[model samples]
Target chain A: MDLTVKIRNKTLPNPVGVASGTFGYGEEYAQLTDLSALGALYTKALTVEPRPGNALPRLVETPAGMINSIGLANVGVERFLTEKIPYLETLTCPVILNVAGSTEEEYASVISRVDSQNAIWAYEVNISCPNVKHGGMAFGTDPVQVERLTKTLRKLTDKAIIMKLTPNVTDIALIAQAAEAGGADAISCINTVMGMVVDINSRKPAIPAISGGLSGPAIRPVGVAAVWRVSRVVTIPVIGLGGILTWEDAVQYLLAGADAIQIGTGNFVTPDASVKVLNGIISYMKEAGFQKIEDFHGHF
Target chain B: MKNFGSSILNQKEIAIGYREMTISWPQSLEAPLPGQFLTVKVTENPAPLLRRPFALSGFDREKNTASLIYQLRGPATRLMATLEINSSIEVLSPLGNNFTLPEKDETPLLVAGGIGLGPVLYLARELDKNGFSPRLVVGGRTESFLPDLSNLKNGSIHYCSDDGSAGFRGTAVDYLKSLDWKELPSARLYSCGPQGMLNACHNLALEKNIPSEVSMEQMMACGVGACMGCAIEVIGPEQYARVCKEGPVFDSRRIKWT
Candidate 1:
């Protein structure tokens, strides 16, 4: 089954990639499933410093999904560079580093620190995070800042740069345009949308942080709509995510014009979620007699 | 410890071959231990994305199946309730660690609160099956919510309720408070349930000097060890330990209780 997807100069073996923040360094899920089978692996968003993250109740379960405010907790770039990057070198599939920061300098600092690593195939700029009280919304919603941050990442490294945009925006296409103008190689759209759940019994928030990002099957359609719109407007390839659980779900994204699809909430449910989707996509290609994953992109 | 391929096994009502739906490796699952829980990924919805974590009630030796018992808490739980017999529930487990079982001669009194039964029933059966006589204390708001305890045939079963609707009318703590600790002061104790109930038991156990273990429940992310999402400030030197790694179960004396 033909399942190759070309983003910039890189050739992905399949259209199924692990969405940022879901796989957590690609090694954690290694104990449960095959990581190499995925088209690519997206690491959790790493900041410049190790984060303890939000307090208790960082997550909550809704009808068909869960809301999380993990606050992009990571071991920071220095440690990730020293510890994570070395481990990543062992994997054959392309590992995309997700970088997030409160300030422009911090983002640049983390990028510069990992800029020399030849192992990394691309960098996903996490301009969206809702749990942090500061800077979470600064770069995500504004078109100009999205452009500025995307350009900054572009200048920092020759490694392919994919700007991740938040769905918590009035104009998602506008942000995608900014990333393109800033020279982003590709764009991964629709990060978690901001939402809050309150525990009616205690008169308190369900998630201890008062609010968090909503994800799961509930967010898939919204993600699909955003990716569909953005992919239509942008010339760069689009990596889509939200509530992608099955092979059919990935097809929806690709058909919605996403060049590739990332498995996010699905990963939390099943660690080998990426593998299932990838295999399913391949199986579908064989059954349908498609020559390539891209051959079916955006027709639906 | 082995990385099983990814795919969610649906939830279920019962397991066929085993008397009780004892999910085992190739049957239920491999990794999840007693205290460790597996996140049940519910794909039917999308707004909330993370899989819900449930303590393993038993171990599955078969790679093809996993066994779990859950109440109709919400959509996720409701979805799990309709699971067919022998149908696999997508699970990640043998998680956390089994409550440290006492030695051959050691007697442990098992106290389970409400649905807290989900995480402690296996331990109770293990002790009973091993000939380690343990008295089972099961508590619930009303007798109607009580899970079937006939599987625990080797032990004595006691029921407690808040409104005097059952065996002891008062709360489980009330029954516990009134119990004759003198007879079993030397017995090891294991308790799991709501924080309030556990705290009451914790104090009573300490006041009576009966060593006890309590399983602490908290929201989690990675379930393995990373993300630090399930940390508790009741154990280790720094007053913090991971529920997923260090324990969903802890020695009552070692925890801060809050």
Candidate 2:
């Protein structure tokens, strides 16, 4: 089956990839599945410096999903370049680095440092991370700020830049358009919905940060709707995510016009979710007599 | 660490809401060291999506079996408690780093409160096999909350209860203070319990100039360090460490107790 999907100049092996943060640095999950079979392996959100992240009680399970406030906990870019990048360079699949910063300059600086790396085929600009107190969701929520940051990053690297849009905004289509206007090659929609789980007995927040970004099955409808809405307004390729546990869910995103799909919290449920989704997609394709990934792209 | 399925051999309730579950282990897989844990999938369904991590309380090399002592804490554990015997459960084996074994000439002092005795019991068994006679101190809110240590060998057990129903009549920290400080200098302390109890143990070991190691608890999703769900503050240049990756057991000085 011809399962490849093209976003800008780079070609993904398939339209199935594991979301950032859910699939660590590719090193930890390498033994669990075949990395080459994946479309891409997205890394955890990395900052300019090492972030300690939030305190204890970082995670809490909700109705059909889980909440987490990891605060972009990661080893800095220097450490990533020195320690993690070398391992990522060895992987057969494309490594998409998710970069975050408090300011435009910080984002540009991180992109500049990593731009020269041959192993990293693309960049997923995490302009919308609700867990952090500063930056992240700030730039992504405003169309103007999204354009400025995306434009700044667009000037820094020729590599495919994916603007990971936040769903907290009033109109996600406006943000997606702004990202496209700023020369973004692709768009990844729905970076966890901002939600909270309270401890009824303690009368306090369950997660240490008081509130957290909710991911998993509970957020799937929201993510699919966001991707469907955003894909309509933007000409760039759309990568959809949120609560993608099965192959049928991945097909829903593909039918909704997502060029590719990323499995987020579902990775925690099954370590081999990406491969399983990929294999299932192939089976679905064969069963439906579809020849290529584009046969069902935005079919609905 | 390898991810595989282990069949249940036996499960028996030792206390109200507490069960001792023994699972079959193939001889091909290496036995887990003291502080390492297995993230067991209590259900195949996505409702309880994440696997629940449990410390290996005991292992029989020749019999090729392992046991986990757990108390019913939440929906996941409740599901695990109802799992019928002989049914295979998907488990990610030997996740996280293990507790540090003591050096020669150092006496191991093991401390645990409530269900924290899971790893502590395993450590004691390992110590005894190495020809070391370790001292164990256990505490609970009441006698019912404490584990039965009659099956364990080669350790002098000191018990303390908050309600004074059994053992001493105060907190575990208070019990530690009642011990002779002079006799603790040559001891290497290992503790696993509530945050307050661990903090107290850390301070007491510091005061006595004895080195201490503590096993920390954190809510986790993927026990293989992929999710970054279990972040713990460490007192070092790097402020955060994943409890699933860096440690479930760490030197007492490395943790930021606050």
Candidate 3:
């Protein structure tokens, strides 16, 4: 009946977390739903400097998904420590600071600046964002660069480090192994899949950037498969995410070997999506006679 | 803002392509003001994955009800059209900033086009109830494209059609230009419509030195402003502001019209 998930020295209260960038610094959704119900609250991506992000028409709807090119719009690390931390400190759930940058030095500097805050529970290294022109998918696609960045950031903080991986690679397991080799505590797999939608009359891309990261129920299979592949290659816990809209979708990831699951695009669909997911998972475990989160893994 | 479920009290088609849906509003929640919006989870189906946002067209404080006027366009709205009365739906409401009231000395000139008539009508009605003589000019492709306005009273309502089949023979901006500025020297503009009409209104306001505000539309996700998906370019250091957060309503001067 226990739902606690442990990653290295840290312990997540449950297995359900709202994905980074989906939950904005814990302040936006505070009025809508209960925050303490989450096992972890992953903040929006924090970079070395504030980003204005992409231009207008940043989002467009597809059949069962939406494409976005937000380009890591954030208030930067200094604002994260000063403006965001005061509110994050009031939350009961573990706050995983999602860090992203264009270079290794920028990533290291961000971690060094905010690493001292006790309110931050862990660091979710974002190396797989597809919307950016630099650093994001570039560092993620190459295993050598992934290993180097992970190792460098590992030395900066004693907190748990979760390497987020992109699905737009030839062999995702290889990248997971590189992260494990570089001393990552855990790995969150399958960032948004690269996708595009075109306007037939205008003969132009629906979004201004021409291409964006596709998320929602459409990318669920890709994420589950990525979790299955990456979980087999790396010994560390695999936190699965992508198009988890319901609790049943989360169970699919747990059965596929994801130690924990994150609700990303589903948050926009239902504000209390994570809470529903967590409650559903608990009911499922009880009905299946499973005691802990690991019991839902490897049963397939 | 709060996320709660409400039963559909009524749903009826008021025009060829548009329908007005009235739902029971919770008395505990603050009453929605003009230009403020709500996002509706259209269906449990995954095809329309995200909630669709709509502005509050009308609110009956005595009855504890709020209504939205939506066009029967796209898969989400098309699905919404099929919803029967008494059907339960999830709603996240009173989101974004509301339209600010004009100064007592200023005349409110409200303009609407196409499906944008909802908030403008709401604003005009609220202004009228508050003892201001608001002038509402509605424009569409033809008379059929506009919603039925027989229920809206206490305000001066003008209708314009492209083919001159309704009231005036031009766009809403054309009607605005046709007004004698010297008569209503303190006229302030508030508009919601197509980009072309909004831009034209912005230009007219600039030319006449009239203060103006506009309701902007963009494809949105997480209407609570978490996703930063509904971005509108503006003249500022930040460059972009979320249409769902900073506005669905903003001063006309703030927008960087192309």
Candidate 4:
């Protein structure tokens, strides 16, 4: 089994990547985990401008999941390039910049800027942002839009472009196909699924934002299923996500045909979750008659 | 995530049957400030996908222990109240930002309600250790529901109960009317607790022109800033900031509390 994978022509030491949003810029939780151990790091979604985010009670616990609508509050692009990007350059793994935009112009602006700088390993295009009332059901929902965005980036820069898809879409396979046709080098399936949690007593929403994206273990099955379904449809590799907590869980995605796995909600509960998951994968491989982590990718 | 299986540290009942647990983890306790919090993995089996967020009441750097206070509110926190000491817990900590304390020689005033006293106590001690003594004003619904956090520090403690069960009856707010506002003419106010209490403190601080900072408690996913899970509106100015990131602590005036 070979756990190593090459995406956008870049070689990853392993098949595990820390899911975006869970590990905020990675700089916030450095003391809690070994940042270098993970195969790669995905930053929090960076919008074209600085945002203050939504209002209070942004989180609500469901029976087996969590709902959030962070409204993509970020330090904007300029601040990220100067302050965050420089710090990101020091990390051992390549940093995948998760870019969100309301318009193609904004997206193009972010790409050209980040592309100009050589710090980032690749660009992770976010099409699943639910909090914003955007240009349509978001750029990723419509397959044509996804293809156009991918093709646009394909023309803009030589860096590997990974289109992040929202699970709420009607057909993830169609979306993935469109991305591939548009020249996307890879696809990371299942950005947060849209969700809402209301306070029964107050008859109001829990989050300051009326609604938010759902993440954590409850969404794992949904995410993995999408990855499996889409991986079967697209020739390009898939970076699986949604509720990945341990190494054993990550291996399931590999067996389901994911070239890589992103640990999202786990980072919130345990910062070193990526390290633990990676180690667990290595140990499981040795015990399960597998030689490498990559060998398990798509065996199912 | 290091789950110790069953080594629960300290559990004590406060306010009805609600109990608070202080768990031990090997992780460093560096980032958390006075008002910041942590997300503790609840349940021997996690029924909830997210860990419950708790205020970092205090921590022992020498022992690598993080203390959390909570009432037995639901199925999850109820599970947390049932842990035994020495049980190893899987946790992520030093999680959020802390409250800002007054400089040395300044007398601080801390206002708290129910379990809200947790973070304020840590702030009080941080101030005390640095040679500034803060006056403690605590409140609760009834004497029985009040917590017995008697060991926090040697600061002058004032108590108020809604049902007249203890101290100056009729709410912590009522006692405020009788205090010598001039004696502490130049004081920085620190507060935590229920929203009504916080609002009252905010109003009073503004009326008195006293500088104030507050700890905002909200249900959160990722006690860090990423999930956008714990943002509170800084009311008057109309901006939303994460209770976990921009703060578990905000200058009282900055909070857009309606």
Candidate 5:
């Protein structure tokens, strides 16, 4: 079975990749698994300025998932290009830089700085950061804003641009269509369902940010539904993510019409979760007498 | 840092609800620093999902044995307390940064609160091996809650209890405030305990202008840096640093105690 996937002119060796924010530049996991075995690596959210992030009590475990209000803390663009990119360049797989900003110009500026790097194959524009107060969901929830930001970014970088959409919207398909119209190369759906946990004893929110993005097994169905709905309206490749823990979970996203899958919270539980998911997909394909991911793409 | 599946060498309760578990690990697993920790997989099941992180209390270089002292506070720890001898547990170890050691002429003053003694006790032992006699102040809710410190050689321990069931009639912080800096000049302070205790010690250290280090605790998902889960804010510059990565240990001045 073949596993190659094309996003613009770039060809991913497989359909599995580690999600942004969950994997820290893909440098830490190299010791646990072979970096070349997976399809792609999406780094953490990159802002124009170094972010200190949010206050304490940033993480809390729930029923079958986790909530985080990390607030996009990162080394910023300058240090990322200097200190981090050298290690990321050594890997054989494609690296997609996940960029976030508090403003449209901030996004454009970060994209402009990274557009020349050979190590980065694509740019995942993050318009849906729930932890921050502005610029993230503000730009993502509205279809017009989504189109405008993508259009502006499309003019700046020659690299493939993938619009990451938030799941908190009333209608996700409309937003996906807007991104496609704005000249986006692909679309990655469902950047964490917005949710929060309360500490009953303290009578306060579990996270200091009061609310956070929920990711893990509990949100799998929501992610599949969003991907299924968005893929129906957009012609661009849909990268599905959210609550993917096992090989079976990855297959569900593919059957729902996601051309590729990104593993997020699963990496925290098991360091080599993406590799395991990739192997599981290949095994299932062989068993079902199917050859390549295309045979089962959107089969549902 | 490395992840190893180490077998339980022996385990027994040292306090009312605390257990001291020693696990036999491969020789390749390097010695963990005093303030470093390990993320433990309490059970074979994934229900709890995240591994429970514990401070490295002790280790034996020749025997290739490492030890962890933890209290039965949550479901994960409850399950961890019931593990039989010889049962193998997955341990991701030598994580986070360690406490900075003081100079030969500087005095080491170690403070611990309740089960927070985990790292403090280890630091005391380490200082002892280096020919420095550290002064350890241990406090708990009651005498029964305090772990035995007889095994900590080459150091002096002052026990304090809330109900005056042990050495002093007040908290560790109160005991710290009672000390006269004039008598013990150039003493470097190292502390780990409840947030209240750590905060009190931080303020006292600031007032006395004694260089201090604190080991902070928070709920963590991945013991590694990837999750960005265990976050704490710093003073002056005011930014967040992951407790799992930047530290479970930091300069007392770096932490915004509030």
Candidate 6:
């Protein structure tokens, strides 16, 4: 009956968390759904300076997914402390601050500035955002840079550090191991699969960025397989995401060796997706005679 | 905004590619205003995973009904067109900011291009109901692309087409330019349309020394402010604003028009 997920010193009330970027600092969904019922809330990416983001046509719909090139558009860390943290403090669930920057110093600076905030429960290191030209996936694609950044940030705060990985890389298990070796409490994958859609009439890329990170049901299989591979390589808990819309889709991640699951693009499909998935998970566990989230894992 | 369970009361194609769908609204929720919008879950199937956003074309408080005008330009709308009447659907209602009303002495000029007719028409009707004289100019590629105008009798309505197959011989902005400025000396413009049309309207508003508001359209994911997608650059320190949150309606002067 224990749905709690423990990573190092922090324990999530349940195994369901809303993905970063989709949840927008927990305040945006406060009016739409119950924030206290969530296991965790991953915030939009916060950078060193406020980002203007990409140009027009930042989003485009595919068959069962969407490509987003938001380029980490955020209010920066200073404003995060002044403007966003007050609202986040009111939420009952754990707040995982999803951090991103264009350089190692920028990443460290952001973490150092907000590391003192009591509301922020953990840091979801975002080294996998594919929309930005520099830093994001650059630090994530290589194991050396991943370990170096993780090791450096690990020293800044005692809070749980979860390295979010991108699916665009070849051999994601290696990247997971790198995060583990550098003192990460856990790792989450996959950030988003790189994809593109062309406007045939205009004869140009659908999004102004030309290519964006694809997330939705279309990338669920890729996410599950990546979790399966990465979970085997690292001892850290694997937080699975990418295209989880229903409880059934979430159960697929739990069965695929993910310790917990995050609803990414699904949050857009329905605001109450996390609560629905959580309720469904409890019912599924009762029906299967499984007492804990771990029971759904390691069967394969 | 609250998510409401609504059922289709009526669905009909009023134009070659445009369809008007009326749904039973919940009395418990606030009635949707002219510029506010709703996102509909077209199907339970995940193929068109994201809910499509549509502006409130009409809302009848007495009957508890709200209507939307959608174009069959994509898979979502095409699927929406196939939905059976009285079938239940999930909708997130009354989202985003609305257009501000003009002063007592100011004339309201509402312009629409193609599918953008939904909110503009609604604004014109609402303005008429409020005893304000409003002028509506709707433009499209041709007459076939325009919606049925018989029901829109509350205010003055004009039509224009690129091919000169309808009312005016040019675009909506061009039609506005041809009008005598002295008659509409104290006019405020409101528009929703293709980006080019919106830009032209913004330019025309600047040239005439009139204030204007524009309803913007962007491909949205989370129709709420959660996703930073659907961002439109604006003249501000923040540099960007979400179409689903800060607008779908904005002051024409605030937009960092390209």
Q: Which candidate number has the best DockQ? A: 3
For residue A227, give model 3's deviation from the true position in Å: 0.8
Residue A300 alpha-carbon offset, candidate 5, angstroms: 3.1
- lDDT per residue for candidate 4 within B1-258, as digits (tens), equals 222232467877756764667666464335356786666777535475677777777666677666777877778777776667776666655556777767654568888887787788777766656667677787888888776656435467788888879777876766775688878768788899899998998888898898888888877777666666666776654377777777888888788768
* Clash totals for all candidate models: 49, 0, 0, 32, 1, 1
**Model 4, B174: alpha-carbon shift in Å?**
1.8
Query: Which residue runs of candidate 1 sit more than 4 Å off their true CA positions?
Result: A81-83, A286-289, A297-300, B1-33, B38-52, B58-68, B79-91, B103-105, B142-144, B151-155, B163-169, B179-187, B205-211, B219-242, B252-257
Q: Candidate 5 at residue A140, lDDT?
A: 97
Q: Individual DockQ of the candidates?
A: 0.37, 0.69, 0.86, 0.55, 0.54, 0.83
| Sliding window of 10 residues with minimal summed lDDT for model 2 chain B | B146-155
User: Which of the predicted structures, 5 or 6, would earn the higher TM-score when compared with the native?
Assistant: 6
Backbone clash total, candidate 5: 1
Comparing candidate 1 with candidate 2, which one achieves the higher DockQ?
Answer: 2
TM-scores across all candidates? 0.85, 0.95, 0.99, 0.91, 0.94, 0.97
Candidate 6 achieves a global lDDT of 0.91
Which residue runs does candidate 3 get wrong by more than 4 Å?
B151-153
lDDT of 3 by residue, A1-300 (tens): 789999989789999999988889878999887899999999999999999998778988888999989999999877777898999999999999999999999999999999888899999999999998884799999999999999999999999999999999999999999999999999998899999999999999887799999999999999999999998888899999989999999999999999999999999999999889999999999999999989987766
Give candidate 5's error at residue B106 in angstroms. Answer: 3.4
Task: Give model 6's TM-score versus the native structure.
Answer: 0.97
lDDT of 3 by residue, B110-200 (tens): 9998889889988988999898889999999898887778644556889899999889999989988998889988989999989999999
Q: Compared with the true structure, what per-residue lDDT tens digits does model 4 show for residues A1-300?
A: 666778878878787788777788887767667888778788888887887765555567776677776667788888898889778878888788988888888888888877877678888888878777772247878998888878887899888989999898889999999999999989998887888877789897766577777777888889889988998899888999988877777888888888889988777666678888888888888887888655676455
TM accuracy, model 4: 0.91
Residue lDDT tens for model 6, B9-61: 99999789999999999988898889999999988888888899999998999
Which parts of model 4 have CA positions greater than 4 angstroms off?
Answer: A135-137, A208-210, A292-294, B1-7, B20-36, B58-66, B103-106, B124-133, B149-154, B235-238
lDDT tens readout by residue for model 2, A1-300: 788889888799888888999989987887777888889999988889888778778999987789988888888899999999889988889889999999888899899988899999899999899988774789999999999888889988889999998898999999999999999999999899999988999999997799889998889999999989998898889999999999989989888888899998887777888999998989998998899877776466
